[model samples]
Target: MTVAGWETRKNVPLVGHQVLLQYRKGTSGAFVTPKKVRTDRDGWATATVKATADGAYRYDFAGTSLTRATTGSADFVDVK
Candidate 1:
């Protein structure tokens, strides 16, 4: 599965934010350390992963107090 077109809250645009991708293996409730990436003007972000490390994954968009923005989360699959 591929995840695309993720965005931030519509109320606020141009808010500094970051996207984190985390995954676990085989129905496990555990999520590993996430990879961080910046977002675009459309609030869209992307995260790529291989099925080799397949599992339930969570997308976290957190605010940066330093940047004074909010955070959000989404879920998707990464086909290897």
Candidate 2:
């Protein structure tokens, strides 16, 4: 599975920042930390993982000196 998202604050793109990719199995399941990636010039980070189970995917950017934008777990996919 490929996950991608933008790290932005006030509509401004944050480049070269660290981003984390996470996944959660079936509903009510605990989330698992799978990978970390860096944002590109466009503040976009992407990660590809082989899906082993039906779950959700989301990316998060930890706050940095560059920006204070942080994201919580969001549902991007629901595999049935």
Candidate 3:
């Protein structure tokens, strides 16, 4: 899966930082593990995930830098 998100500060892109992705399966309260994706110059980060069994997966992002810190989440990713 290609995961993309924007890192910004005060309405401007925050570049050259690492965004962490944590994921879990349906109804699971704990995330398996975390992965890191680096943002581009425009503050966009992408992560390519490997294939998995068809099920509902949830994910979230956390990014931290010298100047900023942020977090976000999304609905389950349904793979049929």
Clashes of each: 1, 1, 0
Ranking by TM-score: 2, 3, 1
lDDT string for model 1 (1-80, tens) is 11232474334443335667777776656777467766666566677666675467666655454343333443544557
Instruction: State which candidate, 1 or 3, has the greater lDDT.
Output: 1
lDDT of 2 by residue, 55-75 (tens): 787777767654565666667
Which pairs of residues clash in candidate 1, taking residues 3 or more apart in a chain or in different chains? 61-72
lDDT of each candidate versus the true structure: 0.56, 0.70, 0.55
Give the residue spans of candidate 3 off by over 4 A. 1-10, 54-68
Structural RMSD, model 1: 7.7
> So what's the TM-score on candidate 1?
0.56
Name the lDDT of candidate 3: 0.55
lDDT for each residue of candidate 3 in 1-76, tens digit (9 for 90 to 100): 1223345333555676667666666656666545677677776777767636433333344534334344565446
In candidate 1, stretches whose alpha carbon ends up further than 4 angstroms from where it belongs are 1-10, 14-16, 64-80
> Which window of 10 residues has the lowest lDDT sum in candidate 3?
1-10
Q: Which candidate wins on lDDT?
A: 2
